[model samples]
Target: MNIGIIGAGTLGMTLGYRLSQAGHRVTVLETGAQIGGLATWFDYGDFTWDKYYHVILRQDEQLLSLIDDLGISPRMQWKETKTGFLWRGKLVSMSNNWEFLRFPVLSFPDKARLALGILYIQRVNDAGPLERVTAAKWLTRVFGRRVFERIWEPLLLSKYGVLYDRVPAVIMWATIRRYYKTRSKGDGKETLGYLGGGLKTLFEALERGIIEAGGSVETGAAVTEILAGEAPGVAVRVGDEIRWFDRVISTAPSKVLDRLAPETKLGAVSASSAPNYLGVVCLALVLKRPLSPFYVTNLIERGMPFTGVIEVSALTGTDEMEGNHLVMLPRYDEPDSAWFERPESEVATEFLHALRRVIPDIESNVERFFVHRAKHVQALWIKEPPKEQGPRHTADGRIWSVNAEMAGRDTLNNNAIVQVANAAAQAIGAMGAPAKAPTAAASRGR
Candidate 1:
């Protein structure tokens, strides 16, 4: 089969590599000059970093398998990672069992109840019919209003904006399970791994494998339209040229599908179900000092703009760049928010101000600062217009539609690469082709 994959991000690359390995000809069309989409890296003079910070957990089987398949396992190093919460001006270390008991933020009884609730959630395979339960209500029932307000409430608001109230409890359960199941020994510290250079290294290897396996990859190619082919194929118009394929798999956002195939019923599938995506303004600082020892610092202040701050060097255990520190200030807003329209300089200044408020020494230690903005970084899965309204995998004869929501619903983690492979493989089989089975040798990372 000749397959054309739209959007050469992690999803596109992985699916293309697998299909090519399965004796199918695959071609990937990428809108960006470089690959990896959200997980792509940007060169910072002496070093390269992801456009947005990304780390893999121990249970990220899909990602880990891909790394080994490409013979990059030696480059993958695992480290026990720590995460903390900044609640009501207090820095609370909440990464371990002992820390939960020792922390002064919650009363002893409140802490016990919270701990028990987390343990219960972990043991239960099912999310307990949480589809009807809102995150705030469920959390308050288990952890009390104080913990909800001081910890979870603010984080949800910062990530979802006004839609926070509508989030289902199942979403929180999925997040907690992913973290709890991946925890390294020694309390609740979770093990995370990073590629030798960056995520881009893994992406590059995958792209090369696809090309070597009788596949083609083209970047800066935009598919303007999706039209039905003369026979059993799909035609995509990239600039002035039109290309035909036995099947077409789109890893592009579902919203893009709605725009391209408006005449087909495929557009309406996810039109009303477009979950809001929060924009992230990442600030890379060549700092004189580190912010904190913890990798992630979750802040909970109502008026504060930034939701989470990640110190890259502290997390990686390597200070490759002199005065090296990369801080990510993620702020949630609608796709069309005023922040997106503002100049990058203004965004940088705002981030610096917010960052300095939390880390006082940051002002004097900073030597260089660069900012990158990701519009619609993640799908607002937990919130409005509710989970039932989310995008469903629909086919209008030839065109296939998929995005974060579809991936999250079908797979364990809505990871970019995994989603692409799962969605594309499903699309291909649905198009009258023999079901492509996962090669055991390939799955074993041989």
Candidate 2:
């Protein structure tokens, strides 16, 4: 079989590698100059690291298994990390039970209610009922009005903006379950894993594996169109060339697909209504000194530009980064939000100004700063997300759409992306053989 995979990100590349290993001829097309998509990295003058923030939890079995299969498991490292919360103009620890007990954000009774709420959520094995309810309603009912207003609402607003009110409770339930399962049993601390050289190493290894398995990867190859082939396959237009393949797997966003392959009516994949997406504007900084002792600090206070401050150096270490602290300040908003059009320097200035509230002396420890923007970082899962409408096979069955957002059982992450890609490959394999050669009329139409 001859296969064409659009968007050579981790999902696309992984699919290409798997199909190639199955003895199929594979070719991957990538629009960007680099491959990893959201997992891609940038090269600073002194070093190179991920453009966006990504951490692996011990519970990420799908991602871990993929790493082991790529023969890069030895390069993985784990670190015990702490989390902090900024509330009422004060930073406080909340990583352990003792610190949580001492947290001044809520009263004693409120704290007890919060613990019970978490336990109740963890006890529910099925998420179906939770999906029918909104996070606001669920939290308010379980944690009471005070906890919901003080903690849950602010966090939801930071991530989902105005759409937070309609977000499904199952999303929050899945998040709590994921982190709860990743905690260390000995001390109840969270342990996060990272690749020694970052995700760049893992992506490069995947690319090598694809090539070794007889697949071709082309970057900066923007796909312009997808039309029905002369025979029973699909035809893709890359630049001025039109290539035919027995099957086409698209890992690009649904909007991108609707534009490229309108003939396929890919819009039906969303059942006419599309899922809302949140974009991220991240400011990565290399500091002369560390910002905080904790790896993650959730900002609960209002009037802050960024949601949270991630001091990745707490886990990645400064030695590999030439003794410079690496911090990421991520601002999530809609794609049409004015923040996306704001200049990078202006964004950096605004973020730095707000960051001072958490670190009073941060300005003095400056080094280098870079800003990165992703148009679609996360998909907002609605209470009734178009269930009957999602990534699926076209009427012809030769074209398929697969992406991280289509992950059924997990949230959008590298692990979920890999799982979706694997499932798509398996389905394609079961289809048997390549399409017959194009007919004379179809060839003339091209």
Please write out the lDDT profile of model 2 over residues 299-329, one tens digit for every residue. 8888899888899899899876878889999
Q: Give the clashing pairs for model 2.
A: none
Query: Against the true structure, whose lDDT is highest?
Result: 2
Top TM-score model:
2
Tens digit of lDDT per residue, candidate 1, span 229-276?
344556788887877776677777777877776666555656666655
- Which regions of candidate 1 fall more than 4 Å away from where they truly are? 88-90, 319-323, 382-397, 409-420, 426-446
Clashes of each: 0, 0
Cα lDDT of all candidates, in order?
A: 0.70, 0.82
Cα lDDT for residue 356, model 2? 84
On a 0 to 1 TM-score scale, where does candidate 2 land against the true structure? 0.95
Query: Model 2: runs farther than 4 Å from truth?
Result: 388-391, 437-446
Residue 18 lDDT, candidate 2, scale 0-100? 77
